[model samples]
Every structure is written in C-alpha cells, then in structure tokens.
Target: MPPRCQNILLLGGSGLIGRYVAEDLRLRGFTVTAIARRYVASQRTSADDIEMPIMTMTADQLTHLMLDRKIQMVINCLGVLQDGPGMDTMAVHRDFTAKLLAAINAAAQPIQFVHISIPSAADSDHTAFSKTKRDAERLIAEAGIGSTILRPGFVIAPAAYGGSAVVRALAALPVADLPSDLASRQFQPVAVDDIAGTIAWLCEHGDHTHHVWDLMQPEPVTLGAVVDCYRTFYGTDRSTRIRLPGFLLDLGAKLGDATARLGWTPPVRSTAIAELRRGVTGDPAPWIAATGIVPQTLAQMVNRRSATIQDKWFARLFLLKPVIFVSLVLFWIASGFIALFISYDAAAGILSAHHFPTALVGPITVGTSLMDMATGALIALRRTSSIGLIWGILASLGYMFGAAVLTPDLWIEPLGALVKTGPAIILMLAALMTLDNR
Candidate 1:
C-alpha cells in the first residue's frame, strides 16, 4: 500500500520520461530502482538529487531480483513502437506489467504499480506491438490491483531515447516542409519532465484511485506551429517535414515492422502516423476533472524541459560520421608505427631469415594483422562497427598468446596485443550474449 516508499522498481529508466520520472521520485525522497539496458543510480546525495536506488537487469535477471528484493512499487514505464525482440513489446509493457502487479499483490503488503500508456489502447489490436499493450491494459485492469495508466500523445522529449526521434530531428532541419492542413491540426505535446513530476504526484495520491490520466498541455496548437517552435528552439528550418499521403503512411508502417525484425531503424509506422493525421484523440478535460492534475502549457513544459539544457554533443555525434572514420584511420596508422618502433629487431630477424611473404606471417603477426585490417574496415562501416570492435578485442587474445608463444613478427606488438585483448574479454562475452540487435 505504501507505493511512495523509498524502494521502487522502474522499467525503462533510460527513456526520456523514465529518466526524469526516476529523478523526480528520488527528489521526493523515494528509493528508486530503475531497470533498463544499463544502470543509472544517482551518486548525488543532495536534497535536490533525490537519489533513486536503481539496478539494471535483463528479463531473466529481473525475475530473480524481484523475488529477492524488498520492492514496494513497480512502475511500467516501458513502451515500444517497433516492439523490439521477445514475445511481445506490449506484453512487456502491459501484460507482463500486470503480472508484476500481481506479484506485488501476492506480497504480504501489495506493491503499487503505475503504468505509462497512450491513447487508442483498446484498439491497439490493429498492430502487433500496441495491441499487446491494449491486451496488457485489460489484463492489468482485470488483475484487481492498485494500478494506474497514464496515456499522453505527441510526447516531445529533449533527448533521443523515444519514438519521437524523427519528429525532433525534423524540427531541426534547415528548411523543413510544413503541410498547410497540418499547420492547423491541433496537438498537445507533453514535456518529459512534466510527465515525471506528474507521475510522482500520482504515486503519492494513489488513494485517489484515479486510474487514467490523458497527459496534455494547455491549449491546442497546430502541428506546423509546433514544428516551428521546436525549430526556433533548435535554430533550424532545413527539415523537409512534409506529411506523407495516407497510402504511403500505411506502407511505411508495414516497412517499420519488417525492418524492425531485421535490426534496422524503420521509417515511422504508417498506422501511428495515420492515426495522428486523422486526429484520433478526444478531450482531456474529463480526466482532469477526475485527477485534478492540470496539464502544463507549452511555455511551462518548455521552460521546465527546454532543448537548450540538453547536451549538444549527443546530436553532434549523430552528425559526425567523418570524425569516426578519421579516428579509425589514425588508429590504423598509429598501430603500424608502434609495431615498427617496438619490434624493429624482430621484424629485421624475420625478414632476413624467411621468405618475403612467409616471414611476414606468424600466428601473432597474421592474427593481429588480420585484426587491424578487419577492425579498420569494420569501423568504417555503420552496421559492423560495434561487432568489429568485439572481434578486434577477441582476435587480439589469439595474437597476444602467439606473441608470447611463437615467433613475434612485427604485427600487433606484445604490449599492444595485451592492451587490445584484455578488456575485450567482457566485450566479446557481451556480443556473444546479444538478444536483439534492434
């Protein structure tokens, strides 16, 4: 019953809203344990910091942690559009979410769960991912636990962790396209931090049994105007942010599903696009009438979570592919020089004694040589870059062992081989243990 306790379990803590929500709870003196691909436990002990005791774990790992930890609240902030790997993203969002609530229910003192959701949940069956959410919502409702679901739309976050990445990117384009009709279509883009603050409010007031909250900002603004505001905030007007036709939108959604399976970023799904274009959301006044949580205005939302406060390097890294290319090349050049400098005698001994190509070849020389070329090329490509790093790290162990074992030709130097090979043990282990690339 004490969902506001110091200890809470949050799913999707890495997301824009999740991060803020976790932070907000910590600010309110709650001990937060957020689960994502990684851990983000707060190190700050300041009164403003609100340290959330977070823990990162995989699905199987989570089950174990839940069984052992003194978890009082489980917040399902995990929502997905493409429904990355596993049985269903929505089930993880909604049904498994309910299951978590049920586990809390079975506790001597039940756990309180707060779910973040979106509109059209009942009709979510039209798509595989969201439909799972729709079903999960129903299951959670049936579970008869103390739970709440908050559905919001056009959720504009200051960072790159959510489905609105393309929308935010489009807003920054130098000359973005704006449809005349879309320029007038109303939207209530909710701010990330506002949602976080509101969630903390709901957790404290769970006694209200106010199950649903349609998060909306005050006053509806046209979509173009929204883009324009974001563009102004970002100081860009280059985005050709034109609206796609209905047919093309549907096609894109299919492509998103297909590409999602292949571990590629798919175009925005036409189904969601079409739904937004069609203006499917209704008034939020009734929900406000129920929970008394007035939505913040665009000005307020922006003031609290302005893009200016976001780290610019995050976006710059996305734009600078050439920098990465140059670094890889430089690394290759440096490796060659370092080998020549450290193993000049070994190089001369082999070259003088053995045949031209044969002397250049030894397990250490060949294996490490292969690593340099492979890693260089791999880093050059977008798809294989991460995998390439893993290979480069693992391949070095073979080379380093040979450097200490067989003839030490002038490929990767003994010290260099050890440097490259050591820490990669974990990297290689992580690669081999991948679940879904997407």
Candidate 2:
C-alpha cells in the first residue's frame, strides 16, 4: 500500500514532547521519521527510526533527508527555554524554521507543517526566546503552507527539562521559597501526552481549518497552587512555604543569567522570572472546539504519574549537578597547588621509601602536579569540559592503580583517603554525562 499524506517527520523527536508525540503517532499506524540533535541506539523502534546529530547538517542535507523519507507532513516540536554556548534563540526558532519551510517548499510535492509554539504577546514579549518564536510563527504564515500552530501553557512531562525541571526541583525542596508578588500569578499546566495525542489526532483527521490553537486547561491555577499540587502528589504537602521578596527573586535571576553566560544552562533566568511574574494562561476554547478533547488540569496530571525513586533523585539533584561539577574542578585544581607547596625533601623521602630514586622524585612529582592542574583548568572551561572530564577519569583511575601497585599500604591507611578516589571517579562520570551543554 502507498503511504498517505500523513507520513510525519518529527523534529526534536528525542525531546520530552517530541518523543511522546512520535510514539503516539506511530502507535496510531502513521509512518514517522524523527530527527533530533542526539539519540541513543536503543531508542529505535520498528515503527520509526531516530536519526540524530542532525543539527550540523546543511540545508541541502536536511532537504535530502526529508525527501528521501517521503515526509508529507512536518511537525516541529523543537523548543529551548534559555540560550547558551552553541544555542541561539533567533537561530533555532526563527532562522531554522524559515530554512526548513523553504526546504519543504522546494520539494517536489507540497507538504503540511505543524509548529508547537508557546503563548507570547509579540509586542510585549521582551525575551529573545519568545520574540524568535513569534517571528517563526509569522514566517510560517507568510510561507502559505497548510499549517497548524499549537501554543501550549506549562507543558507537564515526566522528563525534567527546562521549566519542568525547575518546577520539580522547587516542589521537592523542603521549603517552597516563592516570590511574594507571584502568589496571584496564574498558570494552566497541561500534560505532554495529552498534547501529543491531540496533535496526532489532528494529523489523522486533517483538521487544518484551525490555524492556531491554544492547548491549555479549561481553568487557570496559581503558580503556588501548581507547586502545591506537585508537593501533595509527591507526599510533601506539609512542607513549609516561605514567600521571598521581589528583590531576592531579582538577585536570583541575575545569578542565573550569569551562569548561562558561563555556558551552564540553569532553568531560573531573568526571562523565566519575567514570564513567571507576568503569569501564563491561554484560552482553551479553540482547542476544545476543534479537538473535543478536554485537557487535564495540573493537579490531575500530577496524579496520573506515580512518583518513582529516579524521579525523586532527579528532582532533588537537577540543580545541584552544576554546583558539584564546579566544586570538583576547584578541588582538583587546588589539590595540585597544595601538592606543589610540600617540601622537596619530604616528597623525596616518601618516594625513596617506595623505591623511587631521590633524583627522579622532583621531575615526576612536578610533572604530575602540573598535569593535574591543567586537567582541572580544561574541565572548568566550557569549550573543553568534555575532554577534561575524560582526563579527570583517567587521572583518578591512574592514581588508584599506581597507589595500589607502588604503595599498597595507602589503601588501608588510617586516614583511608585513597579509598575516596572511587567516589571522585563517579563524580567525574556524572559531570561527563551532563557535559553537553549545547
């Protein structure tokens, strides 16, 4: 049988929303080709193939991929809350959208397009993230392609990414520290699976009459209430609540902005703070009229998913990962300097006892210390962080092996300091896992 017009190509398919949408569409018997920046080999399924690391592909390469797959419709689910390092708000949301649309237009047959955007006022949206999204919408409309734009509010997902990570982290905190002025700020969080199902249904039904739909819950809930719902579901309803003043919130936003400049993408930023202060709630009339699917409320969405150990760990450690990484870098660097300060005679005596020549001790100790410091500096740098992490892991393992072979007594020493190397290596691995800030 020949493929239908709904042969879907999903961009950002490895992301929280895109993953669910692609899988949902596939289960409904639609041919899906998902493109993402990165994907694991195991994520591939019989119904779909996930092609990844496509961010660096040229426009011609992208066009070829689309054409080769016989993609009749494209669903762009790409989104990022903050820009960092290789990420640019304008490039991702505006330039890329324009280029993709142009590629689709250049194809032999016309293709339908669906864009997953967020609610934002064009004139009042000061953040680059929002402005670029608005620009992308305008470009889509001007292209005159058969398109549907979906603007959703507070998309709730099991994965901790962007705003969802922040919400989970804050809700997991022992005390909820909220901005005093934000008490009245409203939101209508919707489940990601629900949005994905709606998009899939629209694709199958060919409901292109509604150009734009605000996918949100029927009733609005306050920001505090959203957090409260999470807390209650997570069994933390009795947690203390403290309202922070406006000034403290501003200070935090500034710090978050500073971290972003350093190539670490923290969820709390000036733009996010600004958006939260203004609040986000969209009218659900259009979505309901077209789809006839009632969106789940924030509370109901929270109850649908049972909390797991992994979720709890992720919620608590999401923000602390960067802090721990930075601390590890500093410790590695400081240890090198401290070793250098040790007296030459004292170092020689220890090496002499371990059968190292007195003359060779000086060069070996100095070289190793220098290498340690260099590795730490490289790891601290954003550009070379990945390499640095590999270096750190090797260095840690080398130290342990050398100590065991040369001075086995150190392992069982009274201080047991050498045993701590295991944890240090684990920490390095953790940092390496999240080193890809782009």
Clashing pairs in 2: none
* lDDT tens per residue, model 2, 294-332: 888777788886788887887787778778777888878
Model 1 residue 152 CA deviation in Å: 2.2
lDDT of 2 at 20: 77
* Deviation from native of the Cα of residue 47 in model 2, angstroms: 7.5
Q: RMSD in angstroms, all models? A: 9.4, 3.5
Question: What TM value does model 2 have?
Answer: 0.85
Regions of candidate 2 where Cα sits further than 4 Å from its true position: 1-4, 52-64, 207-210, 241-264, 341-358, 381-394, 400-426, 429-438
Off by over 4 Å in 1: 1-6, 40-70, 84-87, 178-186, 208-210, 237-259, 262-282, 303-384, 387-438
Lowest lDDT block of 10, candidate 1: 47-56
